[model samples]
Target: MNNGVNVTALAVFVLFFLLVTVMGFMASRWRKADNALHLDEWGLGGRSFGTWVTWFLLGGDLYTAYTFVAVPAAVYATGAAGFFAVPYTIIAYPLVFLFLPRLWSVSRVHGYVTPADFVRGRYGSKALSLVVALTGILATMPYIALQLVGIQAVLDVLGVGGGAGSNWFVKDLPLFIAFGVLAAYTYSSGLRAPALIAFVKDALIYIVIIVAVIYIPMRLGGYGHIFDTAAQKFSTPKSPGSLILAENKQWTYATLALGSALALFMYPHSVTGVLASKSRNTVRRNMAIMPAYSLMLGLLALLGFMAIAAGVGSGVKGFNAQLSVPQLFENMFPDWFTGVAFAAIGIGALVPAAIMSIAAANLFTRNVYKEFIRPDATAADETRVAKLASLLVKVGALAFVLTMDKQAAINLQLLGGLWILQTFVSIVGGLFTRWFHHWALFAGWAAGMVYGTYQAYGIASPATKHFGGSAANIPVIGEIGYIGLTAFVLNLAVAVVLTLVLRALKAPVGTDETDPDDYGAEAGDPKTQNAPVPAAAH
Candidate 1:
């Protein structure tokens, strides 16, 4: 019930903050490249990450700040249904396993930096590439902001409370300090910083989870009792339903998970991480080994129930249920362990925020600035622009926290998820075949983005009671929804129909820019330098 900061806990937090700061700058030399000056070396970490490196990098990239906070928060507020994150993680690797290799080979063969770069070359449409790039940058800003939110969440738990009244610096100084550290390292070390620091990030997360999962349960009672208590607490007679979902939500869960898996790799950060891998085997092994993180996630989700059983909100009145985990640890453990838990959350926020900002910046540089604004921009110029852009992305994310509702920021993330998913058809589908025309694909992307954004804006949840709720909508025939999946359907439909229309008009179908055989090729593969490397590790 104590609300004051624990000085011992604060010291442990300070130690982690300093450690990651050192790790970030030191990462520049970890995977020494022929030349760090090259765009490939700086932007993509030399395109030379080995299997273990890629494993940690991709795990760090995909399992993000939201995974650490929102998933567990969802479990605390709801019940078993919040476990949707687990299935999504399970399905994503296998689903991406099918298409990512093809993407890697094509990108490597063509020297493509962004998926938009691939679309531009393959379908020969600057306009289409612009759309993809813009979508990526737009979707990514809120994502980057959410990472800040993750950092804020952890900092909030650590008792790094805001200053008096609306004082700007006091309220935001912690955020500024965290992001400044992140931006500086990302600017200096590029992808290598996150690639290397991911090792530390993942290790700490594992340690935290293992300790909390075992110790928290033993201290409280047991898993069954915890869940049983949570079920009782959250159960509602007004709805005449258990806290968990019925059969209907299960279908929605499965569909959303499947849709999310397809969307997962389409996000530019996911591609940026994958492209950093040294070989196909690295990517494959990353996918194969990354599931271990999911085990941690399953445990993390249970913290919600543990929070309930510990009577996290029992003593207090009107305490934010989202603060359940923080309270749980504070009450059960001494100040020292509490600090470690807070450090885990804080560091977790920084690593992915750094990666997401870098990824978004690279997309803007490669696909937007170089492609559109300065076709002849030098590597140094590109790097400088990226560094500046990364800062702006972080600042923009901070603006989200300041200007918008914190709860609204959460919904914006789901909207980002939906928008990014639409790119799947062009990015992943095109990897296997160039059958879809540039114009067709462009049309598909446009339609999907608009529809998805609109639908997301219209969605009203019971809690928020406004826009942004469930991903699926109840339909007449077979609960057919999942905005990402729906947008994808619209995207494919537009692509297919337009392909036929464009063909009938005998319009020039842009050259088949990528060779399919190159999907299986590697460094020795012919014609590799002209395009960006596709899913290289797996």
Candidate 2:
């Protein structure tokens, strides 16, 4: 069968795309800077976002199009296990409420642009900062690719994944156009573009999910039937799993949920959102209330079951389970509403993609380029390099999109979570205490990253054949759990043991630039507020 684009959905998707493009360009003016070329102003939107704006910015940053597409796809594919994101987000926020505030205080004090910047100052180790910076960028690359996967899922559902008469050019043209707009605005407006566009993205998503939650269940006979139908599908020989956590796999669920919750805030984009807030209060307020998105996620997860009941993506050609939610929207909704839902997914991808790029760029500029390449770079020079770096970051992520599989979002994102979680010991651990030696932290991170990558690479499955899975059977842990979490435990143990050994040897732990007062410092606390970046920080 020849694939053909749905004209109405395409039109609506383009319409919303144009709307955000305009807003993206216009956002450069939102917090009018005398010279927006300064990193503080351009890279972080002048740090002027109030409570509500921070709410939307963080919301948009935390949840991406992948969450919309992949989470449902997971549920659609694996029954109960897909709901791991809900518990992850729920557990993540409380942790953020406690830890992020101090990071924010220190960041605001030193005018830090990335988490690595804070690490550079707190530990006074360029190598340590470089590790954090590289991890942030590497983990983020796959994440941004997953956003494209989200876009591809929508395009596939609309019959635009290279239709029979259309070549690959025609199939991917819309995605390119959307990305071009995103890259342009992100370069011109920096953080403001995504910050402003996030409001629209969140609203459209809320509307779509609210509609899908209420309308789809009614259309599918009812919620009970939807669950029954899904449960029946899983029981068949072709697909075997329980709708609740399986007995032996219970630990898998527990570890995955815990590990993911720990990893969530460590992503650079999440930190970028928090740092962009106008004040510490803004960060605190947003954390407490941000569980609202978690609630939406629960409703969104239901759509996976709804898709199963509707027989969406059952045996469709070129269809992956990731397209399940898009297929459900396309199959069940009217053309116009389907367009709105598609736009939500498209806009959703753009918002996070832009932020992830900006955050990556900031890391390159602050921790890599300025630190090593040109220590004399002024804020303007740093900002210019960051802007160009942002464009490059997007291009790299686009490569992953063009070359990777449909399930790349799931596998790569899982890898991203695992790889990034290694930094938790350095960034989060350093935030609370300074006892861990820099060498010890770096060594621990190295051990975890190497083990996690090797383990994930060895697990084989039908989808990937190699590097095919994120879970494994382990000693002591009878159930299969996330390899990342297990590696993290190793990472922590190694760091603790090494720290004690290194300290006993009287080895240098690097200079601690942060004063205890810095953690508790507020906006008006001059000692921390004007804390200077030391000469050796980089």
Candidate 3:
């Protein structure tokens, strides 16, 4: 396996890539909106997706390129610790099931294009909205880049190394072309592009996973040997108590899992999928069943162990742990099946990448650009600005991949999880009651932001010298734990204390535009009706 392109794999990847590119552009007409230029039309696909489409969109949004690439990689390298991705997904569904219906209902009623718009309407504070949008955009950048990292993993296995050189443009030309197609179609088709492509992505992913899970274990002398072999490898002094979480590492795993569960739905990309649903019922129905994806995730994580069992990692040159699952497929399967698996991984990057860019773009347009720059801007203006911002977001993520090592993308996303978790006090709490003062919420966010950043920056790991990791020492628990969870605790406590003190001081709590009835709204409910357009939706 020299660093030379495999003709068969490259051919398969190009055909699938071109297929989705066409589907993405044509999706602008899918369930064609009467006026397809507005945010509601372009950004949210006219907010008319039913159960099936919403399922695929949410699956594509949450089960990302990172999950497919990183989860297995983590388990292969760190043993039971990597299973944090498993419980996080398991717990996230129930939590989102409880709250997302309300978010969807209120967003549809208020014509909120992004979570930041929800914050602005609920708290009536553009300042808080900007903070929310900025946090979301900052957090999403690493995540989007990680998707490209996943694509690069597949590309690397197919014998495309981009060759180490200073000719950056020539070396990264293939990556540029792939994402350029992504940015172009996402700009034209908007949410509909991802909503349609998600079906294809999920189908390919399901097919690949089922085949791998069933076929790989049999080849590895069955599942029992895979575990036994993994246990032996992790039993050395360098990794004492590694196959299972050590006594001291339990808190780290638990906190990371809980923090991740909390942060998952809070991401703007996740919210974008929820808001695109036609009805609140659609959100609930999908959450009820999204655990099916979690099941697949557990299977995928096992691939890491399978790679170790097959001794797949030792054979390859330039082997990264991130390539565990991809390299495993290439080693175990024939060329045609390897081509299919590579295509699946490649397509998987596109769905979440498109949705995330669109989501981040919507935040900048509605909250930052429109709210700050042009208060009277028309809907058409917002859409146009979003299309361009989406392109820039992709470009920023691409730059992240080319300049830094791939592990940095994962670490940056860990930092992002800590930062975005601060918004729970403002965004999630605002969904239920108005008792939490917006000013207090902002202060809470600041406290968490400062504390989490300092902690994350101080963390030193093997990958980098500073901003090294997301796990840190817990304050009260007196153990290593996830920094994000600790920060959220700070955020919630500050919001609580400040809410009481501010009320005593007679500080102004902003007016809430949404009524209580809006929380229970479903499709066709009067409260769920779209708010009057501001002349620009025409």
- The digit string of per-residue lDDT tens for model 3 on 1-538 reads 4467778877887888899999999998889988876888888888889999999999988888778888988898899998899999999999988889999888888889898999999998988899999999999999999989888888878877466763877767778888889999998999999899999889989998999989999898999999999999899787533788888888999999999999998999999999989888899999999999999999999888999898977755656788888878888987777888888888889899999999999999999999889988788888889989999999999999999887788888889899889988798899998998888899999999999999988988767887887889989878999999999999999999999999999998788899999889888887665554434454
The lDDT for every candidate, in the order shown, is 0.79, 0.87, 0.88
Q: Give a tens-digit lDDT track for model 1, residues 1-538.
A: 5545678988998898889899999988787765565567778898888888888888888777668777777787767667888888888888888877767777777777778878787777788788888889888888888888877766666667653464877867788888788888888898999888888888888887899999989987788888788778766564323466777677767777777777788888899988877777777778888889888889999888888788877757556656777667777778888888777777777777888888888889988899889998877677778888888988888888878877788787777878888777877767777777888888898898888877777777655755556465634445746777778888899999999898888888777676667788766555655454222221
State every prediction's TM-score relative to the real structure.
Answer: 0.94, 0.96, 0.97
- Write the number of the candidate with greater lDDT, choosing between 1 and 2: 2
| Predictions: Cα RMSD each | 3.3, 2.6, 1.7
Task: Check candidate 2 and list the clashing pairs.
Answer: none
lDDT of 2 by residue, 357-412 (tens): 99999999999999999999977788889999999998988877887665655677
Q: Which ten residues in a row have the lowest lDDT in candidate 3?
A: 529-538
State, as a TM-score between 0 and 1, how close model 1 is to the true structure.
0.94
Candidates by lDDT, descending order:
3, 2, 1
| Superposed model 1: Cα runs more than 4 Å off | 162-166, 238-244, 315-318, 462-465, 472-480, 526-538
Q: Which one is best on lDDT?
A: 3
Stretches of candidate 3 above 4 Å error? 161-166, 315-319, 533-538
**Could you tell me the lDDT of residue 447 within candidate 1?**
91
Backbone clash numbers for all candidates listed: 23, 0, 0
